[model samples]
Target: MKTAMLEREGFAALVLRLRAEGISDLDLLTAVEQTPRSRFVAPHLAEHAYSSRTIPIECGAFMEGADLAVRLIERLRVKPGHRVLEVGTGSGFMTAVLGRLSERVVSIERYRTLVTDAQARLDSFGLRNVILRHGDGAGGLPGEGTFDRIIVTAAFPAMPRAFTEQLVHNGVLLAPIMIDEDRCIMVRLTRTGSRFEREDLFEVPYLPLTPRVAAFL
Candidate 1:
C-alpha cells in the first residue's frame, strides 16, 4: 500500500513539473494537488494518472491529459459563486476540480456507465456541488438555466447553438472545435451580452462528441 506521505510527495512532484511547464494558476494547482487522480482511474493504471497522458476509462471516450486539463481549466477562469456547465463528465476528475473552483457544476455525459461511475467517485469525495446527468451534451442543460462558464471536453463538428445561447452575459466557453476528420483546435469563446468573441487557443486531438446517447450493455 502506498503511504499517505508517499502520495503527498508524488502529488508535490507532479505540481512541481506542472509549475515548470508555466502553469501558474495557484488555485488550479492546489485543486490538482488536493484531488487524487488515482481515485478516477483503475488501480493498475493509477501510477500514470498524474502524468500528461490520456487515460482510458470503461467508456469509448478517453480522459483528458493532466497538462491539457490544467491548461483548459486555467483558461476557463472559474470563480467562486459561478455556475459551470461541463459537457463531458468522463472520469469526473475535471468535475471534481470544477467543484472546488465554482459554486456549482452541471456535468452531462452520454454514457450511463461513465455517469454512474463518475457520480460515485464524485459523491465519495463529498463533492455535492456537482450534478451529473446521462444525456447528449450538445443539447446543453436548458432546465438548469444559463451558466457563468461552459466547458466541452470532446470535439464537436459544429458550434453548438445551445451552448452559446445558454451562456450568461460575459460567460466563457472552452471547447475543441473539430476542423476535419483528424484535426481539432481548442477555442475559447466569450459571450458578451448578444455577441460572442472567439479565440483559438491551441490544437488538440479529442474523441468526437456525438448527439446520440450511448447504449450501455
Candidate 2:
C-alpha cells in the first residue's frame, strides 16, 4: 500500500515538472499519468522510471527521456483520430503513449527481443491499438498504408525519401537528423502536395538509425 502511494506521488511530481516545462495538454498529461512507465523498464531501473531521464533497456537501446518524449509528441500534434507510425519502438514506452493519443499506433523495432518484450508489456496494459513489428525502421512501413503522423526515435544523416513517401497528404513526420559528427537536430517534415515543408526543432542526442533487422540478440 505504501509503495502504491509512493508511485502515485512520483507520477504527480513528474507531471507537475512536465507542466512547468511547458506541457499543457491535458490529454497528453493524463495519458502519461495513466501509463505505468516502470513496467516498460528493467526492474533495476524502476526507481528512475518517473524521472525525466533516459532509461536504458534491452538490446543496448535507450528510451527517450519523459520530458523530451512528451515534447516531441506535442510537436507532432497527435489527434485522437490520427494513425501514427512510430519507428524505433525501443522500450515501447512511447508506443504505449502514442497508442493512447491516437487511433492506432504501428511501431517498428530493429531488435526482435525489444519487439517481443514490448508486445508483452503493451498486452499486459491492455493496449490493443499498438501493433509491434520486428523489422528494419529505415524504410518505414510502406506496406502498412500511409499514416497521418510518423515519428522516428533515432537520428539519421538525412531524411529518408521512403519515409516522406509513406506519409499521407499533409501528414507530419518528425525525426532527428545528424548535423555533423557530434550534433543532431530534430526536423519536422509535413507533406504538402508534392513537397514536404521542413521545420527544425531542437538538438537531440539520439543513436543513429541503423538499417536492416538485427540478425541476432
Candidate 3:
C-alpha cells in the first residue's frame, strides 16, 4: 500500500488518540503518519498496518502502534534537532516514526534478527537518520556523546544509570520502570544537574528489561 493510504485509512484517528493522551505536536503527528509501518512489518503481517494496537513481528516481539508510541515520544519533547536513542527497535516502527521527527536516532535491539530486518526495512525507505545496533539493551547504553531524548520500550526493574549518563543535561529518558514484579509505570525522567526527576506517567506491561542490567551498574 502507498503511504497516502495510511493517511486516509485512520491515521488521523490514530494521531488523535495520541493527542488525546497529550501528544499535540505537529511534527510528531506528521512523523507517525509519514513513516510507513507496513514497510517495517514482516510481509505476512502486512494486513494489520493500520490497527491501533501492538502487532507481532519476528520472534515473539510486537510493535506498539502509533497511538502509544507517539504519546510516549511526545512527552520526551523531541525536537527537530534532537538526537534520540531507543532501547528497543521492534519492527523499527517507532524508530521510523522517530526518524521523521529528529536529527538522528540510534536504536538498539537485543534480538539480532530483528535488528537486521529492521535495518533493511528502514533502508528501503531512505530514512537515513535511523541507525540500528544489536546488543544487550538492559545493560544501559554506551556514550556516543549525549542525547536529548532516550526511550526504552521494554520494562526494567529500575532505570539504568547509563541511560541517565547518556542524556544531555535536562534531557528526557522515557522507560517502563517497575515498582513491583507485576506493576510498572512508563516513566519520564528528566536529567537535572546530577540527578534525574522521575515522573510516572502511565501503567504498561512489557517483557522485562534483560538480565544484563546488572552488568552496567
Candidate 4:
C-alpha cells in the first residue's frame, strides 16, 4: 500500500474541517488535533489517516475514521474524572482520544502486535493514563473494575453480559451489533440497576468480535 504522511499543517486543516462539520465539542476537537493519526496507520496508509475513512492497520484490524472517533467520544460524554474501558484498541487512535477525554482508559486488544505497537505509539506522546492489554476484548477487563464508559470497536452479535457486568450504574456501552450479512448498527447500551436500556446510534459495517485472538507468529 502506498502511504502518504499527513503534514502538521494538513492535520490542522483536518481539525478545522471536523469543526466545520458540526463536531462542536472543544475537548474532542482538540484531542483529535493534538493526536497524530499518521502514527497509528501504516506508512502507505498514512495519507488517509485524517480522512473520515476506515484504514487498515496491523492484525487486519481497521481504525475507525476521525469522524466516527469524534462522534463516539462525544456520545460517550467522558468527564475528566471518568474511567473508561475500551474493548478494542485497534490502532490505539480511539484509545488515545478517550485517554484525553477521560481521566483514565483501560483498553484491551486481541492482537498482541497491535497491543505492543499501539502502546508504543501512545507512550511516544507521553500518554500514561491509557492501559493496553492483550486479551479477548469480548471479556471486559474485570481486574480494573467497573467503568464510567465502555466502547467496543468491533461488532458484536449481541450485547454481552460480561460487558454489562463491568459497566458501572448509569454507565454507557457503545458497540455495533451485527444485523445482516453486510449491515451492522451501533447501539448505546446503558446500565441502570439491573436493566440495560438500548438506543440505536447509527449503522456501519464492522469486523465481528471474535472468541479468541488470532495466532500471531
Please give, for residues 1-217, the per-residue lDDT of candidate 2 as tens digits.
6546656877887778877877789999888877877777776777777777888888998887777888898899999999999999988888998999999999999999999999998998899999988898898997779999999988999888999988989899999999998889999999989888999999987978888999897
**Tens digit per residue, CA lDDT, model 4, 1-217:** 2322355655666667767877677788788777878888887777777787888877777888777778788888788999999888888988998888889999888889888999999999899998898888777876778998998888888877888998899999998899986788889998899999999988875878886776871
Model 4 TM-score? 0.90
Candidate-wise lDDT, in order = 0.85, 0.88, 0.78, 0.82
Report lDDT (Cα) of residue 20, candidate 3. 74
Pairs of residues clashing in candidate 2: none
Q: After superposition, how far is residue 101 of candidate 1 from its true place, in Å?
A: 0.7
Better of 1 and 2 by lDDT: 2
TM-scores vs. true structure, each candidate: 0.94, 0.95, 0.88, 0.90
Candidate whose TM-score is highest: 2
How does candidate 2 score on lDDT?
Answer: 0.88
Cα error, residue 110 of model 2, in Å, equals 0.9
Question: Which portions of model 1 show Cα errors greater than 4 Å?
Answer: 1-6
Model 1 lDDT tens row, 14-93: 77877787887888888887788888888787777777788888866777777778778989999999999999888899
RMSD of each: 1.6, 1.4, 3.6, 2.8
**Which pairs of residues have clashing backbones in candidate 4?**
2-44, 3-44
CA shift at 8, candidate 1, in angstroms?
Answer: 3.0
Over all chains combined, what TM-score does candidate 2 have?
Answer: 0.95
